[model samples]
Target: MHVIIFSWEYPPRVVGQLAEYVRLLAAELVKNRVDVHVVTYHDFLTGAVEEPDGVKVFRVANPVRTHVGILTWALTLNQEVERAAASIYYQVGKQVALVDVHDWHFIPAAVTLKNAFGLPFAYSVESLEDHRAPPANTPYSMSIKSIEWLGFYEAQRVCVKSEWMRDEIVRIHAVPKGKITVVKPKANSWIRDILAMYKSMAGGAGKN
Candidate 1:
């Protein structure tokens, strides 16, 4: 099965756990012999299309020149996502079975991909209610809520990390309970090995 993943960030440009999660999931999917393609922001350094962990990673340039605010950035990200997804469709020429969007930040991108290819898409709500939380009077918050609502309506499945998030989206956002699935996040074993190696190196240096 061909799966296209959309995330705002991915390694080696780690912003948060989302990037790590994407990396881990992609690796697992690759291990299972699934053809996976990831579309994300261009790496600031290489700017080259490369396969990381057996998954094809495509990076697109962010078009927005200035970071006016969160809302503007979100809108621009969506625009870039649409452009990237279209490019992927044209180049790949194979319809994706599923498009997995990481978080609310990638909702616009996911929606664009879904619309452009008419493919089934799933959403992963990494940070729940953070966008809707207090100082909610801002235009950015409203825009986020609107985008999230659209995503909720469009996605075939709403995947979340915890039951709290699933419940919140169902309760506050009025998303159907049946539409939500709670899948707990698992730490990547490769990352654990890397951390252990770093710790060992630090210990050896300390002994020296």
Candidate 2:
């Protein structure tokens, strides 16, 4: 199976847990013989394209370097990511079976591609914006929450790192219990196995 992943960071561009999480997961997917391609924000240090591991990597420019806050950064970055993804999609002949997005940062791109290509997308919810911010929601925090909710709404399946998170998602977002899954990352477990199970249940929904 082939999977296209959109993230805000990747190896050598690591900003936090998401970069490491995606790197390890995508590498494991490659080890399992899955076609894995990653599209992420290009830092000034890394080139536009490269293949550090077995995974194909594409890096695009982050729209602005100014400090406009997380909301603006995410929005601008998503636009660039979507443009790059569209170019890569047609360039590669659109062999991508599905889009696996990491968080709200990738929502705009993932949703755009899903609509353009009729492919299903999965949301890997690491955390909730509301939970991350202070009790009183500001405009910035609300923007993040809105984007996060939209992502949960659009996903064909939602993968959470823990059962607590799954419950939180259901409670906060009102996503059906059946659609949320607790797919905890484990050193002993193969991401391929988990992904295979997901695909088996996903059926034709994930493919174009």
Candidate 3:
């Protein structure tokens, strides 16, 4: 099956541990014969490249260079992200099976793709604004929370690293327990569990 992964960071763009985590997951998926494509952000680099391990990486840069906060920055960059992902969709003959979003940064783009192209997406919950920010009810934090809520509501599935995170998501977003799956990345069953998640969603709706 073919899949697209959305992340804000990748190799040579490490802002946090999620970058390496996604890198390893994509590589594992490739080893199992899955067509893995990653769409991510870069300051100056803007294009696609095939990695040595057979993963296709598409890097997009934010067109507007200035922003007041993460919200504006992410919102502006999503246009570019959506453009790149759409290009991949048509370039691959519209065979993209699933989109795995690593965090909240790209939820808008993913949701747009889902609505416009019938592509199913999964939200890989790495962190949450409710947990990250000191005051969660601020307008800015609420905006982020709203995006998280939208993602959970739209995704075919929600994958978390632990039971704690799954519980957290349920508590924060009111997401149904059945909609969330606890799959620890790189564990013994990591590949098997993740493959099952992908296969399950891959057979769902997509552009016809």
Candidate 4:
């Protein structure tokens, strides 16, 4: 299966554990004979390269350096993400299986690609704005929540690391329980489980 992964962080640009987590996941997916492509952010080091592990990496830098907050930064950076993913779509003969987005950061780009090219995407929940900033009723927080909601609404499937997180997503976003899958990160069957989800989503591609 061929899949594209979207994450805000990856190896050599670690802000937290998620970067390393995604790196390992990509490598494992490649090990399972899945063609994996990652589009991520790097401030200075930006471009595409094939990692020795057989995972393809595409790093993009934010066009606007200055932003009042992460919302603006991610919004501007998503354009680059969309462009990079689109280029891959064409270069690969438009035969991509599906896009597995790692978080809410690149939801807009995924949504756009889905609508424009019939490429289905799965939303991999890392963290939610509601938990990041409690009482997410304020205008700023609501905007982020709206993006998260969009991802849940548009995604062919939603993945979370735990059952509690899956419940929280259903409670906060009203997503159906069947739509969320609790796939433990780095579990013995982690690669197998995620590949199953990818195949399920890919099977239903262009139906969205």
Per-model clash counts, in order, read: 0, 0, 0, 0
TM-score of every candidate: 0.81, 0.90, 0.97, 0.96
- Which regions of candidate 1 deviate over 4 angstroms? 43-48, 130-132, 187-208
lDDT of 3 by residue, 70-114 (tens): 999999999999999999999999999989999899999999999
Best by TM-score: 3
lDDT of 2 by residue, 1-208 (tens): 6688888888778887889999988888888887787888865643345466688887877758895687777788888788767776777787666788888888988888888787778898877886777652888878787888888888888888888999988988899998886776873665754686458544755335
Order the candidate numbers by lDDT, best to worst.
Answer: 3, 4, 2, 1
28, model 1: CA deviation in Å?
0.8
lDDT tens digits, residue span 64-155, model 1? 66887867776786776776666666665654566788877778777766666566677778775444476555676777777788888998
Q: Which 10-residue span in candidate 1 carries the lowest summed lDDT?
A: 199-208
How far residue 10's Cα lies from its native spot in candidate 3, in Å, is: 0.8
Best by lDDT: 3
How big is the RMSD of model 4? Answer: 1.4
> Higher-TM-score candidate among 2 and 4?
4
Instruction: Check candidate 2 and list the clashing pairs.
Output: none
Candidate 4 lDDT tens digits, 1-208: 7799999999999988889999999999988998899999999888899999999999999889999998999999999999999989988888898998988899999999999989999999999989988988989999999999999999999999999999999899999999998899858888789888888888888732
Return the TM-score for candidate 2, rounded to 2 decimals: 0.90
